[model samples]
Target: MIRILFFILIVLALGAGFAWLADRPGELSLIWQGQRIEMSLMVAATLLASLISAILIVVWLVRVVWLSPHSISRYFRARKRDRGYQALSTGLIAAGAGDSALARKMTARTHGLLSADQEPLIHLLEAQTALIEGKYDDARKKFELMADDPETRELGLRGLYLEAKRLGANEAARQYAERAADKAPHLPWATLAALDYRSQTGQWDEAIRLLDQSRAAHVIDRKEADRKKAVLLTARAAEKLESDPKGARDDAQAALKLSETLVPAGLIAAKALFREDNLRKAASILEKLWKHEPHPEVARVYVRARSGDSAIDRLKRANKLEALKPNNVVSLATVAESALEARELQLARAKAEAAARIQPSEGIFLLLADIEEADTGDDGRIRHWMNQALKSPRDPAWTADGVTAPEWLPVSPVSGKLDAFEWKMPVAQIAGPVEDGNVDMADEAIRSLPPVAIAHHRDEPVQKPVEKVVETPVKATAPVKVEEIVEQPAVKTIAVPVPTESVIVPETVKTETKPAPAKTEEPVVEPFFGRPPDDPGVRNDSAKPLEKTTFRLF
Candidate 1:
């Protein structure tokens, strides 16, 4: 509508100009060179009209000759470029879908129809399709060719890495991944692979540095970096703990400072302190950790800190811990160990009984057996504990990985920490051997025990009180049974033959040489499971030097 209006305006202006020109006149000119000339108005007007029309026709002819062919060729070229891009897009989709046949067909068509520079992506798509089709040779050739292009170099390398991994050439894959990481550290997969390779080779420092680099590159979360650093620090601490325990302790402490709730660091730090005999420090660390997150191993050490208590006391504490966090294996195991530490044979056995009832663990029974062996020198108890351990159901969570059977361990078995009280058995000197007619087979018993139950004497008495009681808990249940509780004064001699039983008969007896009328106590009775006591003051009939047990007070 605007074009029509514009045409009408142009026509009206032309008509008005024509009418004014016709009405006014035309020009007549006389040359001044030599002569004069005259012309009519109609003739000059017609001449001017012919000149303007000829100039317009010449301009239109020039435009048609110079511009139209080039425009037409450009339009066709653009259409072809569009079709090439279309084929390239289809080939890429086909490659992604693992349709090698369609990709190959499109690749050939694209190459034939388009220039190399115009269809760079076709080669990448073809190589990927070859790889998906398991044509590694073809894929390698195509990828190597594409590698010459800087834009596709990393892509080619990544494809090669995948091929290497598929072929199970881990070293080759690692090399490629390292190159990729070096070239582009921000690429997450390459960075992770490089770190994994380093970690597998035990290059912890290098791995840690790489992790730091990844963090700086914003490739990993800060929290994850801290966690990985903590893990590495723990490994370093473990390595140094043996040769340089102080250094190990420092490293562990540093790790804990970085991540206060990390269990491994707490464990390692506690162990390092304990190795240095810094029991108070170790106990303090564990106590703090237990308040936040209770672990079984920590509980075991905590129970051990409360040393010198009978097994019952330790168990009371452990049971309280269990009440707080039920079915705690570490606390239960420690309670079992506490009995051995206190040399409370009955208490240790009772802890084992309670632990076995709470959860089926062999460690508890082993602990009971160790205590029995140490207190009474009983081999039968060791066998009994071993049998109980064997019969007990296995606890997958309590048992360490790869162990088929859990072994019994002694409490405070560390050298210089073992309980070393000596039993006071004494005898009179013999003069001569007479006849063969007296061996009291009904009374005495002796047996060798496992070395785990044996305690070595400390060269020096502890000046400071050992922090053996890490925890003290009040009892909520009924009191422990005291039928097994017997009081016997320290004995000095024995005049009976050894029996095969496990119990230490009479529990205790005072020396016969001491004053007798101080207290005429009733004969002590053994608990239900214990070996019955022999007759008091029974004379031995043995004449073969009367091999009586004896002790000399220190």
Candidate 2:
């Protein structure tokens, strides 16, 4: 619109100029190339305008002729570049699809058409394809060729690392991962691979260092870094345990401090302490741990540590523990055994009963048997405890201390109960004579037995009325009264001993009573419930046969 208006205005102005010039008879003159030229003003203006138009036309003709070839060439070059890019794109797709042969052909065509500087992506694609085909050697070559290209360097290193992993070259793989990590620490795959490599090689310290690097680089979250650090620290602790248990203990403790919920660290620390003969510390650790995790092994260790106490006493302590954790079978068993060991027979029995109520199993019966046997040595008492075991559900998890069943043979068939068929004494008789004449020897033998077995064994009486001292779980010394002396200004008196009313002396010196050789009776070993007689007639390898054995009664 502006161009049309300007053209109309120029035409009007020119008409007006011509009318004015024609009306005034105007003329102008100019000198050029030493020649004088004269003309009217309108004629001069027209002549100058005509000269400028001719010069513009000649310049237009020369420019059109001169620039046409270059323009045509540029259009063809652009088309060629576009076609090259198309080939590169197709090759990349094919490479991603694992069509190595097609990708390789397209890659070659792309390379032939595209400039080296423009086709780094194609090289990367070709390298990836080679890696897919398990051609690590070729892949490595391609990646190396493109290593200088900043855009592809990290990717190439990742591909190289993957190729190294495929070839089982862990060291080489680690090297590539490290390089990639240096170049692009935020790359998740590279960081993860590097972390894994460090872990697998037992480079915990290095792994931890790199994890910090990853965190600083914003490659992983803080929580994730802490978790990874924990895992590495645990592995390091395990490694340290073999060479330096104390160091291992520190590491395990550190790990636990970092995450209290970590069970492995606690367990490792406990085991390390136990190995160092720090049973007290181990028990403390276990008790603390039991509050969180009710593990059977932890219970076993805790019970073993409190060997001085009866199963009943242990049961009471365990009961207190149960206040923190209710109906915990492992804790219940620990306490039951402790109570029996402490000679708190009733408490042991109650705890065992509670355990049975919660979960009837061989363990509960075992606890019961421990309490009964601790107070009475009667074969009948032992058998009664065995009966309880037999009646209770068989727990395959229970093994008689060190006794192991045949590997190939199945465990006892008494499901959810003790192995009823295996008994050492008669179960039918609940109470009977607990001891024979040889009480001293029997006491010595009982003392020699393991704490658990002794706690469960029935107490036997000595023929000589031997006075046995029962120890309280906790001991207290009687307070002694001290006589205080004051200065001369105050009168102080010391307490005097009270005089006995009478004194008696025996005519003869008392001596230990000689025990008679009581009749040795064989205990009856019951198959399912009661103990049958030990078969003396049948020859056996070690222990007495079941039929002739006279059962001890408690």
Candidate 3:
């Protein structure tokens, strides 16, 4: 709007000036080549303006005529470049779509139209096509060539790293990743790969440095960086514990400071402190750890912190630990074990029972058995507890990837993952119950024993007991006769002879009545609980036969 106004004002000023000149009617005179001429001022002014306009038109025409060929050449070049770019774009799309044929064709056309030096994307497209065709060698060469160019160096390194990983070249992959990380520290993949390489190779200090770099670059969060650093520090401590206890102690302390919940770090630091005779410090660390979560190793170490301490002292220490984390299975078990060692049978039995109630496990049951044996020297109670121990749920251990370990480890041996081990129950395989027939046979064996035989096997005298008899089903073909003999106190004993050719069915005694051919009668062997009377648990190779035996209560 302002330009329009200014143009109107300029035209008005020119008109007013022309009108004023006309009204004034001034005369103009000029002498050219000794000839004198006179004309109106307005005519000379108009003629001057016309001549300037004509000069500008001629100059513009001459310039256009001279530069026409170059303009035409540039237009054609631009058209070709546009076509090449179009092919490249299409090829990239096709490559992403997994169309190898179209991508290959577009790659060839793009190469023909655009110079590789001028169009870097053309090289990328070609490499992608080679990858699509499974031409790894060609792809590798293309990426290597790209790596030489500063503009694509990081991208090239990433590509080469992936290829190296695909081909299982660990060293090559690490080199590429390190190069990429050097070029661009913020690249998450490169930083992570370098970090993993350093960690896997036990270059923990280097790994920690890379982790810091990653955190600075915002590739990893502060929490994650701290966690990874803790893991690395703990691992380093474990590595150096045997050789350099001081250094290991420092590392472990640092790790525990970062993450107190880390069991390995706590254990390692406690161990290092103990080795240095800093018993109070080690106990302090373990007590703090026990407040969060109770661990058996921590309890053991805490109890053993002062090696000169007696069993009663250890028991007091364990009680202190249990007080920190009340009702925990580890705390209870530790207390129970300690009490048993201290000959505090009542306390041990109570703690063991409490531990079993909290988490029914084999360890707790075994501890209970120990308590029972120590408190009451009865074989029956001991055997009962042992059987219960065998049937109890398995105890928690350091488990990783389905593998259980008796001791804690910083990493999983199977997967090589840091802090992989966890204190938990191992996965148990599912098994179906025993067959009904087997269960019935076992039940029948227990029932078939005479009352006198049962009483004779017991270590204690029997009180007045009620007796129940279970009838066995017999086959019609084989019938056996039972002879009864009356005994004192309204007791009676019955004995049944076995048929020669009959199989014993414990649940339902069935016999075949069919008699074999009258041949020399061999001594009949009755099946006692599905075995011969004299058969030991193991099979014997020696053969002895023809001894007939009668059933007796003893």
Q: How many residue pairs clash in all the candidates, one count each?
A: 14, 69, 4
Q: Single out the weakest 10-residue window by summed lDDT for candidate 2.
A: 415-424
Ranking by TM-score: 3, 1, 2
Model 1 lDDT vs. the true structure? 0.61
Q: Which wins on TM-score, candidate 2 or candidate 3?
A: 3
| Model 1: lDDT of residue 241 | 79
Candidate 2, residues 395-463, lDDT tens digits: the string is: 433233234342211112322111112212222323221333223322332233322212223434443
Q: Model 3 over residues 513-537: C-alpha lDDT tens digits?
A: 1121234466432223232353233
Give me the candidate number with maximum lDDT. 3
Task: Show the colliding residue pairs in model 3.
Answer: 477-512, 477-513, 478-512, 478-513
lDDT per residue, candidate 1, 1-554, as tens digits?
A: 99999999998987887788788886787678788777867667767888998999999999978999998998998998888878888888888887889888888777866787766677787787787788889988877777667877777778778878888888988998898898888888788778767765667678778889999999988886776667667667777878998988998898787678766677779888877889789867877777676666677766655446666676666655555554455555555565566565566566555555555445555666676656654443456566655644443332212222222111112211111111111122131111121111101111122232223222322232122211223232333222221223333322222233322222234443222222337643221222325424322346344334433211
Query: For every model shown, what is its TM-score relative to the native structure?
Result: 0.53, 0.49, 0.64
RMSD of each: 21.1, 22.4, 12.9
Off by over 4 Å in 3: 1-65, 361-554
